[model samples]
Target: MIRCSAQTLVALFILTNITATICCPQTCSCQSTPNVNVDCDHRSLTAIPPGVQAQTAKLDLSYNKITTLLPEAFNSLSQLKYLHLKNNAISVISSGAFHGLTSLEKLYLNYNDVITLPENVFSSLTRLKYLYLNDNAISMISSKAFTGLSNLYELTISYNEITSLPASVFHNLQNLHRLEMYKNKISSLPVTIFQTLDKLYALDLGGNNLTTFPFGIFNGLNNLNVLMLMRNKISSVPIEALRSLPSLQHLHMFNNLLTNVSALKDLQNLKTLKLDGNCIQVLQDGVFERLTKLRILYLQRCCIETVFPSTFRGLSSLLNLYLNNNELKTLPATLFDDVQNLKRLYLRHNELTSLPSNIFTGLPLEDLELDHNKLRHPPVILSLNELHYLSLSHNDLEIIPTTFPIQRLRFGS
Candidate 1:
């Protein structure tokens, strides 16, 4: 009798629903000022709290004691865009735990105890964009774990105990941009493991136990930009495998067992090359001839005793050269000739007893570090106009040259 028309009654029902949705849960603190955000983190919670608003966009439940994710645990949060479950003791996750979270864009399960990812564990999150599972104990992952995450952009699973990966584990993530799995126990990879990841931009596989790469290991990654394979046991590399990465810019292979680097001559777009902590005893001429766009080169701690004069022939744009901590007793006079744009040179902790007078000629050198060497005499530093700071510290110099400008020089131990 109170409602005169059906339209008025429906409008009253909608108003009542809206009022119920904005109400905050009793246990968790909610904010409706900006978007609906719920903060349930660090509550020592053993389970998901009840009465969380259905309109909440962000829900933080990290640092809790929840051990397992039951199925349909978050079924009521259909509007959740970000769910933070990091730093939890979650070791088991039901396959349908996220069945109703269709709108979830980012999921943080890092720093948890998840040991394995069962099949269809995340198939319901079709619109997920970012997934962070780093610092977990995940060692086994089903090939279909990420079956429907087509829109995923970045996936970080670093610092885990994974020893191997299925070849088709990432076959569905066509739009994935970055894949970071560093600090794992992976020793070898399937040859076609990354054949379908054409849109991938950065791949970080450093800090692993990889001994060497199979031929055509990086076949279809033409768009790859940053490749970090440092801290492995790779003694040698197949040149054909490196030749496929035409778009690679940064290559970090430091702290490995590589004694020869003739495989890096074809990286024309390379800008940064880090090869420190190896055993390459000598540098042949034109070794880096094709890397004309290289800016930074790290050859320190390589046990290098001899460097050919034309070793840096094509490095005209080189800015920083680090040859410190080596066994070099001397250097070629024209070693720094091709690197005209060179700014910083590091030759510390070497066996250099003397230097050629014209070694620093026509260089825009700014900072020169020759510390911790056996040099008995200083190099010609009078003609270097751009020289600002020169460190001759910890050397065996019997007499400091009077004609050389000592204003910017540091000669004491």
Candidate 2:
């Protein structure tokens, strides 16, 4: 009986040892959804804790004071698929820091102090599809830093101090779709910088120091949809610069130094065009003759003083037009004749004193903004049967016309 009792105790001791090894770490909370998920976020821990199970699939370690990511920091979490390390003070990431995480698909390292990316820092993350390094101080990225991210679709490096990029930096990212590098100090790019990004759709390079549009820079981006170049120092946009972007729909070139826009006859698929805050003084006829698909046009604060009679000849699909904050003193009576689908017009902050009685005849206009102009009388809006919202405040109105269509108005503020 004593021998049998001793054997039973030994068996129990072995089982207890196995249980302790697979237990959750002391600083983290673990939940099992068939696969383990560990939450150690905001724990004030200085480093990754031990005793984490090997089957952990998701780990949250954000909002911490972790200073460095050692090579062996995540050596055991091989099954980790989603790792959140954002909002950390991480400044140094040792080589092979993510050595065994082969199944990692999404990684969040934004809002950190990482200044430089070592070559092959992400060599183990072959399946990584989404990587967020935005809101960091990353000034330099090695040409081979993204060596193993073959399937990456979205990469965001916005709000950084990166001044330039190697021409071959994005050569391997062929499957990348969206690239965000706005709010940086990038002044120029190699003409072949984006030669390999064939599947890219959206590119945002706003709020940079780019002074000129590099010709043929978008050569291989045949599927690009949205291109935002706002808040740059660009003075001219050559037609060759945008000739390859046939799939582009929304083009935002606002807040630049462009004096005039060349013919946009190639962008037949454009829907929204924003050229506000420029030095555009005149609108040449047929400048937008081919943009029949354009719906909304923003020309506010463009310093426009003269608009030709056929300035809006081919914009039959235009719904909203904004010409506020210009120096226009008069508009041609037939300026908006072809815009039969126009619903709203904004002509505020100009020096207009009068409008032709038939300026808006036979239209379905809904909203009209003529405020802050030098108008002495309300322009004839009797033909606008669908007019509901009108703003005539801050003008030089003297007498309120008794026959005005004020009954159909909903709000006039």
Candidate 3:
């Protein structure tokens, strides 16, 4: 070994530092110019870089071990639009951490260990639109937690340990469109939970512990479109719970314990109905007689063993029908005679082995699935004039007429 020169040793040290600084931290990215993105993740940073100023448009600080914010860390980010801090070990975000980020739009803080945040933590994010706080340990949120998010469009707080919500949690969010609070331990919804949200479209409250229904929860939701009530223990609803919603389009009540549906026939604007995975083995003769605009119907994986023709006659505009993965062995030949606009039909994984020759008479079926059944050949429909897609996989098929698909197979066998 020979002694190295001073200049040579210094140059070697500089190269080593450059290699260690190749990947940036997740909490903040510092680029030579704000036009480009800088990734500063997994660096275990304690504070945001001091040089941060209103230049970066997108700053990703996700998946870090940051526990505190210096407040001044975001004083320079006036143009920041997207800020992602998901999968981080951060437990605290200073109330002023977003003080200067007025132009911020989307904020992601999922997969963090945050238990709670200051009520006004987001008070300065006036232009913020979307907020994601799923997969976190947040137990309770202050009423003003969303104080300054006036223009927010979507707010997802799913998969958290939240037990309750403040009535004013969405107090001033007038333009709010979609709100998802599923997969939480929430036991109740504030009577005025959505009172001020006039433009709200979709609201998801699945996978909760609510036993009784939330009455008048949607009293003033004039623009409500979709309401999901799946995977809950709810057994019944208030008489006018859903009838009050006129703009409602899609209503999902699957996997609940609702045995009687006398309250559903009044949903005239309802387009799609998913009532699968429930104890609803019997549908009152005219249970769906009023859902005339229904386009898609899914009753799969439920306790329904038989259906009356009148049960589906209400869905005259239905296009797709899924009744597979059930215990039904057969359906009457006239079961679907009323659905003139039907196109796609899935009846696979059933106990059916055959169908009458006129089983699919005069139907506009383009996609028909009868696979995984005890069948040997295709349904004996004389012709599928508008048929295009057919799935018959994994069946006990043994023979097919040579005249079938006179031309070579084009899509599937």
Candidate 4:
């Protein structure tokens, strides 16, 4: 009995070696040093390679010519945790194509020619955590397309041709945290489209053709932090559109058609606000009175010619301010009185003729640009003790002012 047991042990070792040799396909290279990783990327194959080892964990099939994903195409790869099929011509995915990949946690299907997704195509991948469908030509998605992916956290479908989505498309994605649908043709969204995404933190809808923001569309997103609405056609923002977001930190609404910013008075938790490239002509008083936590503010290229004295009264914690490329002829004396923490201030490319003597007193500015203006003398009359860089080029200054603090200055152009 002892001799028979030794022979059986030797036979089992031989069989294991044989299986490893035949498991790796001829068209791909497989490695077992760091737990079976396959590198089949850039292979111009038309179909999924056969004989992939069942123990393989990571598979890269990007930049391939594969056009179709038949049913159970990856059934042999039951242990696959990451699959890459990006930059492929894959236009069709039959139902149950990924039927056996229950452990798949990340799937990359970006930059494909896929135009539509059938229902139940990814129902078997229940453990998928990150799914990238960006840069695809997808225009239609079935309501049940993402039915079983309960553990998904990030879903990016940006840079597509999708014009609209079903109201119930994201109803089951309870754990989703980040949803990016930017650079699409989405003009309008249903009122209840984002009602179920309560845990979402960042939502980007920039570079779309949206004309108006549906009122109360963002009522339930209390935990949202970043909201990007740049490059849209939104002409006005109703007061109720952003009153519910208490946790919002960054709000980007640049490149729109906004003529007034009175709708942003309630977002007290805001840190950065971008309102550049709009049609705003004047800064109204108390428009930003409640934003005490504001740090960075951008209002460039808004065609402004006048600013009220109390426009920036409550921005005590402000650090960076941009007011370049405007039609301003003069500024109020106390326009920046409350912004004592300002470090970088851009007031270039304007039509200013003179500046107040005590305009920059008791402030710690690092970089100040006043170029391309109609100033006949140095703009800063008060001593900037911590000033390091200053630009006075392209101005009408006949001679440098004697009060200009150039002792500790680093650069002047």
Candidate lDDT (C-alpha), each: 0.90, 0.88, 0.77, 0.87
Clash totals in order: 0, 0, 11, 0
Please provide, for model 4 over 148-215, each residue's C-alpha lDDT reduced to its tens digit, 9 standing for 90 to 100: 98898999999999998888788888888899999999999988888888888999999999988788
**What's the true lDDT of residue 222 in model 2?**
91
Backbone clashes (count) for model 3: 11
Candidate 2 residue pairs in backbone clash = none
The TM-score between candidate 1 and the true structure equals 0.94
Candidate 4 lDDT at 136 equals 94
State which candidate has the highest lDDT. Answer: 1
Please give the distance, in angstroms, between residue 323's alpha carbon in candidate 1 and its true position after superposition: 0.5
- In candidate 1, list every pair of residues with a backbone clash: none
Candidate 2, 374: how far from true, in Å?
A: 1.1
Error (Å) of candidate 1 at residue 218 is 1.1
Better of 2 and 3 by lDDT: 2
Per residue, candidate 1 scores C-alpha lDDT tens digits across 322-366 of 999999998999988899999999999999999999999999988
